[model samples]
Target: MTNALVFLDTETTGLHHDRRPWEIALIRREPNGYTTELRVFVADVDLSSAELMGLNVGHFYDTHPSFRTDSPMRLPAGDEEFQTGPGVWLAVEAKAAVLVERMTRGATIVGNNPTFDVEVLAAMLRRHKLCPAWHYHPIDVVSQALGFLSVLNLRMLGDLLAPELAEDLTPPVKSDKLSKLCGITPPEGDDRHTAIGDARWVQRWYDRLSNPLDGDDETTSVQAQ
Candidate 1:
């Protein structure tokens, strides 16, 4: 078991491994319920892909290009310093240093699709001749949710085979998306595509799974943090 859980998420220039991450967020939660949040915006990088995706997903406002001298897009929440004359621009080495400072050894990384985030960060680290700071295995919420659904389906079958076991089994229901599992209904004004917003959602999903509510009928009022 780990002493702390680091919920992490990233917003990249694109989906490919070669793409760069312009923004990253991490929320470190200790066993005592204390939490610290860090969000970083890399100063220099291509924002074309990130802009397009964010627009398509309705999270990024369709404003002036981020690279423009008079860009209209608002800086990510809590990242005002990056909104200088041209825009935020952190060198690769500086970004790496911040990541190293936050990601200490023995801390379990948690994310929605953790592998992608890990691979992107690893690529960045390698480019700077640095090694990964966290453990190899990350806690992936998507995979965990899939496993839960699989076991739930299995128990349903078992109960059907033996009625006596029905009392201990939850009724079979179609597996749903992570939003449904955590009862998260993204509010109209909520920031969606940002790294910090997504990381918080993943953390809340993990919490819900850790302490499931009574009477499992595939729906609950457990709101995302």
Candidate 2:
């Protein structure tokens, strides 16, 4: 197990590259044989059915075995919007706290689509005027999958190249998190667009695919402190 790695996932209003997360989830791999799960929500953000439909993101939660619920699960209640930028700042604050609490030097924050994850995270930090205490970057699993396969699409890659892990995941329709790809059935709980919850799933999926113990060279921890 990678003691220093932080598996990260995020849930946002939509797939817009500039969008911000309404919730966050993080799972830290401790030096000891323990993992910590951290979840946070932006209390002020609000989303309507129509706005979410416009993004075509309703199915991301509806189809997932672990996250479907009647009431919005894993999210704070109130009026909030990432487009306002203040909510983005709050998210950065929450993420930084999770990092410090773990006492990690540098984190390898793994995600299914790291480009968007990293960009949103960095933008959130900038909005908050905060910098992560540890060096963190979004690890793009798609690129990693591409390295293992000639063609690339989450569903296609999940079907062909990801057999080793796919058996564990629920096949994704559009923009599902990496957890579904890792065969990790989310616990029976509400997945209210929390970034940290999503991050934990991504981390687990990353470990499943790039576990060092399994003799795969792809597992790379951040620069050890």
CA lDDT of every candidate: 0.59, 0.48
Summarize candidate 2's per-residue lDDT along 110-195 as a digit string, tens digits: 66676665565566666655655445555766555444323334555555644554433333422343334444544335453445
Off by over 4 Å in 1: 46-93, 154-176, 186-188, 214-225
- Scored by Cα lDDT, where does model 1 land? 0.59
Candidate 2: C-alpha RMSD to true structure equals: 9.6
TM-score of each: 0.65, 0.52
